[model samples]
Target: MAYETVIVEIDEGIATITLNRPEVLNALNSQVFIELGEAAEELSGDESVRVVIITGGDKVFAAGADIKQMASATAVDVSTNVRPSLRTFNFIENMHKPVIAAIAGYALGGGCELTLVADVRIAADNAQLGLPEIKLGILPGGGGTQRLPRLIGAAKAKELIYSGDFISAEEALRIGLVNKVVPADQLLIEAKKMAQKFAARGAVAIQMAKTCINEGLQMDLDRGLQYEHKCFSLLFATEDQKEGMKAFLEKRKPNFQGR
Candidate 1:
């Protein structure tokens, strides 16, 4: 499907969503959010695509939610819009297939929130990340409140959100907010490499692992253990698991049919 705010390209089991609004620093307008949801759904449904990358073109990953649109939205209106954005963003995180956030330039406010949802994030060395929602007398309406703490712990998330200050990629990595930092020119190169590497793995096992961790996060300690065991048991029933083991013993790469 075509999108006005972003471009989608799929090849070699990798799907890329390019934020197309370089003119506006790839700001997250309502249209962008809707299109983002559509793009994510498409990537998830396509069996040929094993990995997905969300990124901005050249200038910026995103400057965050379009303030122009935010400026005109009332509290109720804002709530309605933010809900879908949050859902789509979280959907990306929860996707069975791994999603990579390839961030360059500025990833601020909603932009940074969007990146926070990815299974892995690779940022340009000079890229800037911050949650400056407090600067607008608001908080990170997206999953920033929930995901940030999970990614970087409570105190660090608080400091970044409370201060609303931009931190360099090095700082973000040190705080455990991102997986790796690369040169700006190598951002997409490295992200695609990682995505393809993940795509080459056993899809079912990868998906199950993601589910186990996500479900465990919300459950109590005792329940989390039960949930993890359930996830572990479910894997034994899948063909991919059997293939994975066979391939390991045979010293060959497993061919996962995503069963």
Candidate 2:
């Protein structure tokens, strides 16, 4: 589908969603979130797409949310205007396939929160990331307070959010905010490489694994293990699981049909 604030491209089982508002440094807005949710919903039903990547142009992933759209808003506007955008973020997080964030330049405030939704994040060496909403007399309205602490530690997440300070890509990597940091020009390439790796795996198993990990982490250890075991047992009913094991025993590559 054609989108005004974003671009969607699907190739070799990978769907790339590029935020495309270069004039404002690809800032997130209500329209962008709506488009993103639409794109994600489309990809979710596409059997050909096994992995997804969310990115921006080389100069910026996204500067932040569109302040112009929010500056004159009242408390009522927050619920009417902003809550739907948060729902989009939730959709991205709950997507069936894995999502990777290919970040380059400034990924601040809502931009940083967007990355937190991804399963993996690859950033360019020149990237600067943070939730700087506190400077605007607001907090992150897009799952940052929840997801950031889960990625890094609570203390680190609190410090960054409270200070509204942007961290370098290297610093982000050290703190476990990003999975990898590559040269600026290689960001997309690396992201695609990772996406391709995921695409080659057993689709059903990968989905189950992602579900087990994501959902399990929020539960107690014993309950989490029971949930993992249930998901593990459920995979035995899938063709991909049998094919994967058979191919492993035969020393040959398995062809997963995503069944």
Name the top TM-score candidate.
2
Global lDDT of model 1:
0.90
Q: What are the per-model C-alpha RMSD values against the true structure?
A: 1.2, 0.7
All candidates: TM-score: 0.96, 0.99
Residue 149 lDDT in candidate 1: 94
| Tens-digit lDDT track of model 2 for 1-259 | 8889989999989999999999999988899999989999999999999999999878899999999999999999888888767888888898899999999999999899999999999999999999999999999989899999988989999999999999999999999999999999999899999999999999898899989989997999999999999999999999998999999999999999888
> Model 1 — TM-score against the truth?
0.96
Structure candidate 1, residue pairs in collision? none
Error of 2 at 146 (Å): 0.7
Between which residue pairs do clashes occur in model 2?
A: none
